[model samples]
Target chain A: MIDWSSFAYLAAAVLFILGIKGLGSAKTAGTGNVLAATGMLLAIVATLYLTRVVQLELILGGIVIGALIGSLLAKKIEMTAMPEMVALLNGFGGAASALVGISEYLSRQGETTGGMVSIAIVLSLLIGSLTFTGSLIAFGKLQGLLSSQPVTYPAQQVVNALILSAGLGLGVLLATSPFSELYLVLLLSVALLLGILAVLPIGGGDMPVVISLLNSYSGLAACATGFVLGNAGLVISGSLVGASGLILTKQMCEGMNRSLLNVLFSAFGKHVESKGADTANKTARSFTPEDAAIIFSNAETCVMVPGYGLAVAQAQHAAQELATVLEERGVKVSYAIHPVAGRMPGHMNVLLAEANVPYEQLVEMDDINPEFPETDVALVIGANDVVNPSARTDEDSPIYGMPLLDVDFARNVFVIKRSMNPGFAGVQNPLFFNENTMMIFGDAKNVLLELVTSIKES
Target chain B: MLDDPAVALTILVLALFVGVEIISKVPTLLHTPLMSGSNAISGITIVGALLAAGGEERNLAAWLGFVAIILATINVVGGFAVTHRMLAMFKGKEQR
Candidate 1:
């Protein structure tokens, strides 16, 4: 019945692939968005043309409303809220897939055979439901509505395993029978619950991995739905997402020195007994802004590492001012941007860019990691995890495998944190307790401003 | 003249996807978010695949459908695993 819809679908698929490729590089990322959006538009139009049962008015109205809501939210959201926004978008995707699956199931209720159709229905229902709930949990954690602590209980892993086993058993049962909608519903509910259970125990530090994993789940669900529909475009595109998401997840796991299973099962953010308190007491050195300025005034080269605290204090401009003042004093200043710096991905870069920091001065983690060893002064601005020495020296630390900025190797390290508290990973930073390190306790913005003034005076 | 609608639609979707992939790298700021956001777009393909396999009446089609479903399931599971891992890296000290 659909005459030319296939051609349109093919075109859309090509665009989707191109969009993803473009997304890999920073230079052409915006154009990639336009291209992807265009592909989506083409696909939506083709789908509308091909569909026989769905009403045009309803579909168009829904699109308009969704677009408006998304645009409005995007316009108003702050950078700090980006992670939650991402989580919310993921939830929306899961909900959409679930709704579509239900619609398909309802439409073909009488004509559909039980066996494979049942599997499709159950898979869609289960994955979609889990993605929905897991995304919401991630959103709540990122938005601070829920406690960021790893909510753990005795036998937590055992309970999670049981839940998964029960859910899988139910899915298998539903897949084998056509009249097992009740079992399907139960499986869906259990999967949703399992998703919540899985993510709830993970600490805030693990949210990025959770979000990425949820993203992958959402894509695979889409692919399953595509299989149910026999849509080639769905298969290809879904596979692309699933593959890329997995690779990114693997990269993230490597970034944190964690295994996929450890991430899934480990209860992160538990307060370790104060094993390093005495060590902290032995080498803790506090410094004033004036003291920091004195050290900076004489430094030949300074590397400034900014973190989420800088964003929270909105201190990018102040930091830049301090950098400029140092440069004026013949200090070769540059910013070290850890790939995973800030609350959201690239949070530091966005802030620095907003503050008019030059792109040339922003060095990535890999390039800058070794430079720290040759630097005269390493000025850390509210950064934590990226500079943690445990990532290098401590095998038992959760972040032990992730690459770190070699700030610990600098001749003099001045860490500007608000307090002596451990980072989100809930591990003590041995860097804070190092002989060359001096902790400056104050708001990042105010402290940077003071440093700028002191540098100017000197 | 009657043309095969399925074949035409397939070509169009593929083209659109290729175009998107080519253009996705335009904005440096958008690379991560777009990659993240497009995950939703990829999910939409599941609906079409499911319907196609469900509509097939043959044994071969059914087996193909089964394989597709399983592969799709693996993608979903593995993808979510990856996304969560990426997000966890940002949960460093300042965020905590």
Candidate 2:
């Protein structure tokens, strides 16, 4: 029976591998998710039927409570809040793994525990505590509960290193003397502090990397827990998650022209004086939704550029509505998505997807840049940094040399924004003052909705 | 089970490669779902949580185990649920 269950675990692991492999394409993504879920269920059932008789009530009670709350959260979370939700849930997972380590240590009170098990317990406590606190900090930053400014003390790097070293030293001590309960407590405390310190210096713009890295840590924590139990399945899945998180972290760092170390240490998005050309004498031309609508009605080709402002205004649905109205009037519309346009990687894609915007219509920056000159109108919605042309022309600009959408190359441009404020990077945008540009300043959702109505009436 | 550290290490290394290989091929468009999906897999630690909670004696360990079970369960249930919800919303050019 034990052998059979182990075989089932092996099969479940393969299913997980296949599932993730299938996620590489749009056509197979839905099936990939389902396959992974099925693997989870199978693994759970097999674990229940193992030789160790699980207490029926406790197991059922835990599952029921978890499922109820989990389902509620899944159903109620807005798409804009997905990053925060993922961070929060990852924290819970990390905490659970740490608790398992503690519980296992306590359970083996008088027994002569294996050296391997003792070492695994200590490592689990370190990584799990780190993941829990780090993920919580990431969640807070994403949710606007904590300041996006990098909060740091004097010699911050030194303090972080000391805390980390102390935690590892305690791990070594606990491994040598497994019965020393106080060592375990001290180790957990130090590791928790390490997590907070490690993440506190990361500013709002660097959240994607921090979140991805914490996700990797959570997987490592679980892998350590698997070591404590000598479970092959846990080790496999945990390592997989760890690697995937690292890859995503690397991708996010590259997209924003920030290195992993830079993201971890920098306090971005805080107040910074602009270094670009001063436009004190310049003024932006303003237009109403109705005027923008008339212009849109005459355009043959339109491109939508979405940014974090789009998410903040929850304008994805309205943007989609406007696109449909324009498409019906014989205007060709496509969306231009900058890799880092929103809060996270692929943020714009996810928002547009939530609005049922067809994936085929979403053109990435490189693919759409060449088409801008031929385009009749480019709609800039709640976006700034991605469309800012200063990145190409102004050498003194903070965001110079960063790749951007060539929206200014279009024959006509209309921007839906709140004011003449600079973007998150605090760089003034030259595109807004271009001769062909008109700012339809308002909440993105309201303006898009009005544009849809106005365009239809025209 | 405790005697096979080499086997466990081998599985860990192999899984790490498989993960990097498969995910590196995944397009940027599916990155969000990929993160959330891998998150659900991380809940595999729930197996250990189950054994600890269901063990004999109502000791401190058992109570802690109960809490562990709850958290891991939430990770598994919530991660998969949210991933599914998100994936269902991703439509192709013709579907919409």
Candidate 3:
């Protein structure tokens, strides 16, 4: 006999690898998802049959209840809310790992636990608790339940450092004396508080990095749990997540020209208001919808740049509508995507994808920056900082040295914004006051609708 | 039978390499799906949760196990469903 249960887990591990490979491409991502889910099903089934730990009725009930809630949330959540949803799931993964560690400890009940086992339990508990609470704070920021700006006060770093040192002391004490559950409880509580304190100082603009880091923490928690459980499948999948998430976090930080340490510790976005005072002398030229339409009618090529504003206005469909109109008029249309645009990585891509914009029409910043000079109009919608020339020209600007789209290079630029307000980065845009740039003030959806109408009439 | 730390460590080290290698060349557009997909995989803790829940008899261990099972199940099921929903929305240049 093949001992099908062990074989099933081996098979599941292979499927997970295949699933991750599939997800690397946009084309195969759906199939990749299915493969991973099939693997999960296999692993779950194998565990249920082989362990026979709890009654089948209890297992079935838990699965049914969990799956029902999961399905409802999956179907109901808007695509724009995907980042927070991922954060919430990451939190749950952490909680599961910690809970399993706790249960295992209670079950052991002084079974002569070795030093290695003690170390694994403490690691699982520490990482899991931190990930759980850290992810919740991330979810709160993304979902608007908490302030998206970095929350800091005097001596914040000193206070956090003290808490972390105390946490480590407790962790060490628990590992050395496994029978004393008091240290374990204290460690868990301190870890929870530490997670909250660590994430609270990071602003919403750095959310993608925060989310990725939390996802990695959850994986590391699971990996520690695997060590305690002596399970190969958990070890493999957990490390895979841990490595991939850390890489993604690094990539996002590099995209913003920021170091990971700076993003986590320094209050990056909170210093924007002080920088806003410099914009007082700058004045932007205002244009009407008809004027924008006239310019678009004569344009040979136009690139639309979207940001959080497009998402806030729910104007992705209108953006697509504008693109279609311009294309019908023999004008070429494409999108310029900033990596950190909107609340998360690839947020604008998701919004445009939702509106059914063809994938080829969406261009990354590096590929499209050179295309700007030849372009007739760079239509900036609800975006300010990413297109600001200050990133390259002004040395004292907070966004200095960050790579930005050269939207000002276009022959004519039309910026659609709600007001003269500075962007999320709190820096005033010198590009807004550039002679080539024209500002159209209104909600992006309304302005885009007018642009589509006037272009059609022309 | 797989209790050897050396064995588990080997798998962990290898899986980390495979993870980085597999995700090396993704376009910026797919980053969200990448995050969600990896999230679903992390839910593998459900295996440990199931063992904890069923391995004990009407004790604190059993209750902790049950809660772990519920949380892990949500991560697996919800993570996959959300990833699929987002991936399905991505259209190629040829699509209408």
Candidate 4:
């Protein structure tokens, strides 16, 4: 038998720990990435050393092909699609763990203490299946293949609750019974169905939380598979992933001014058709591009807030161009990024960064919120939820308690949207109707380009 | 002694806390790149599964190994493809 590669594995695990630590701080994130890559390299090499019956040709080929594909992907994908990318990666991890569990189960069917191994295998299978299906649904929504609006039926919450309970009940039975394989398959099917049903009713507004929660589930499945395989490293790394995913999910919940249970059960803001009607009825003043350009052209300082609509219109470059012109005319320009802006977390940052916006100019919600009142203009692009006044003024608003941009306090506010339609959360934005706010109803890219020209002509 | 489930559980719990705390503190600016980078790390599980499956001589083990290798490979390849497409969204455009 090959010697255990314990020392190398330990070193790799340490590297992972350090990498994760480094990732927390922006300044050291690059270093953390390097460390994690090194750890992975070390782990792979050590595993090779421990393999007595190695198929060198196959392994080498796989590595080369995987590396080439990975590098190409890294070079090409746009930042706006990062959330879908993340969801896809989570699915990949789940698939990997599940496959490993299944292989181990099949190999050791007769020899192992069947109870524990079977339990681990079943758990892995269930969680992995759920993660895979749930993540795909999230990807479809984020990519706009599926409707972003919540698909709700009467008694939807009750139906979901029953499904969840039944899935859990089946999981428990699979764990205890001797006829484990039959129950295992049942559990997997139930979990898959549960995943689809769980995410189906979730509105676009709650997708970030769904994605985070699914990520956690994938990690836990990996951890269980690690136990079954008797791999310490897998268990550790998997648990780390699972735990972090849960915490991130919680943070997302808090960011949306929601509780975890409420997100899961209440399906908050899933069908706010009535709320949309209320917002439409509110009389809001409008401004032509020319009239808005005059205010923008004269402003001493301006802060632009880009949202999902801006991305949908592919207007970041246009916005950047407008900012450049405004700056040349002596206006201080910056971008405010809410933590939960866009579909996924940090959605606006990725979009702005793509447009070559400087990292320093991308201010956080807290940093820029206080500065809005003193600013000359707060230009909102394809953004609604992050700027909604309901977070502060209306306690009954579904988005109440969520922190928001203080654009309402600005001397002048320009909102660029297709219409007065409610945002992802399906809530009316009172700011649109404010006297200081002017609606610029058009595609963000076209409107921004028009404003740039009008500013130049004036 | 090291195989004790309790020890495993403790390690799992501690690792998770540390990991979550670290990821949560990452600034908004780095969230995208970091997520993409870490995805590569997750892919390493493929290598582990490969070793476990191929090295064993038994029939069950060999087939298990084969399946593991195939699935893991798909996961790894597909993950990179999607990530690359996502990162491409950031090209061009310089701020003044």
lDDT at residue B4 of model 1 (Cα atoms): 40
TM-score (C-alpha) between model 2 and the true structure: 0.95
Per-candidate TM-scores read 0.82, 0.95, 0.97, 0.89
lDDT of 4 at A267: 61
| Candidate that would win on DockQ | 2
Q: After superposition, how far is residue A210 of candidate 1 from its true place, in Å?
A: 0.5
Weakest lDDT window of 10 consecutive positions for candidate 4 chain A: A272-281
**Per-residue alpha-carbon lDDT of model 4 for A57-123, expressed as tens digits?**
5555555655565555545656667788677767766766666665665555546453556667777
Worst 10 residues of 2 chain A by lDDT: A1-10
Full candidate order by DockQ, most accurate first? 2, 3, 4, 1
Instruction: Categorize the docking of model 2.
Output: medium
Pick by lDDT: which candidate is best?
3
In candidate 2, what are the lDDT values of residues A91-182, reduced to their tens digit? 98899999999998887777675478888888888888888998999888888899978897788888887887888888888777747778
Q: For each candidate, what is the lDDT? A: 0.66, 0.85, 0.86, 0.72
lDDT of 3 by residue, A336-428 (tens): 998888676677888889899987888999999999999999999988878889889888888888889999999999999999888877878
Model 2 ranges off by over 4 Å? A110-114, A393-395, B2-4
lDDT of 1: 0.66
Report the first chain's TM-score for all candidates: 0.92, 0.94, 0.96, 0.90
Worst 10 residues of 2 chain B by lDDT: B1-10
